[model samples]
Target: MQHFICTGGCDGESSTPGVCQAEDCKKEGEALTPCNCEDGLHGEVVEKKDEDED
Candidate 1:
């Protein structure tokens, strides 16, 4: 799964790898709508493999 760092200061999926020590870091490692974290910063796009494709 991939994630992007949110620079909006809000809360969303964390793109940062490993555990984010940031208190405000809203790490979301799932298949859900991404939320702005701080501003300008966008979460990484996670690619999923379809069973049919596999």
Candidate 2:
């Protein structure tokens, strides 16, 4: 699967290509780029909680 991301390094991501929403990128009408990673795995950090920690 592929996803779209902001060309200007914004947080805009979607399943389909679309214009960026960042103020700076929006000003230049930046478009999203096709993500070339596995299911858009951009090194995101996930925090798992222990069932007994809470």
Candidate 3:
């Protein structure tokens, strides 16, 4: 199967079947954030950003 990716900070479909490694990308069905498909066969690593307090 193929999984999609969310290049922007939103929860979208994945082209590949795997978890998103983008620090900003939140897991599907969870929250919205900047995320992309895993880079390599291994999982991806993303830098966690702090939420702004309004």
- The per-candidate count of clashes, in order, stands at 14, 0, 12
Error of 2 at 25 (Å): 3.6
CA lDDT of every candidate: 0.39, 0.58, 0.42
The segments of candidate 3 whose C-alpha lies over 4 angstroms from its true place after superposition are 1-3, 7-14, 28-54
Worst lDDT run of 10 residues, candidate 1, spans: 45-54
lDDT score of residue 30 within candidate 3: 49
Q: How many Å off is the CA of 11 in candidate 3? A: 8.0
- Once fitted onto the true fold, the runs of candidate 1 whose alpha carbons sit more than 4 angstroms away are 1-17, 28-54
- Across 1-54, the per-residue lDDT of candidate 3 in tens digits comes to 334544334435555455455565444344233334455321242335457433
Writing each residue's lDDT as its tens digit, candidate 2 over 15-42 gives 8977777776532466666775674554
lDDT of 1 by residue, 1-54 (tens): 445443323334455544334454343333334444344334343334235422
lDDT score for residue 11 of model 3? 38
Q: Which candidate model has the greater lDDT, 1 or 3?
A: 3
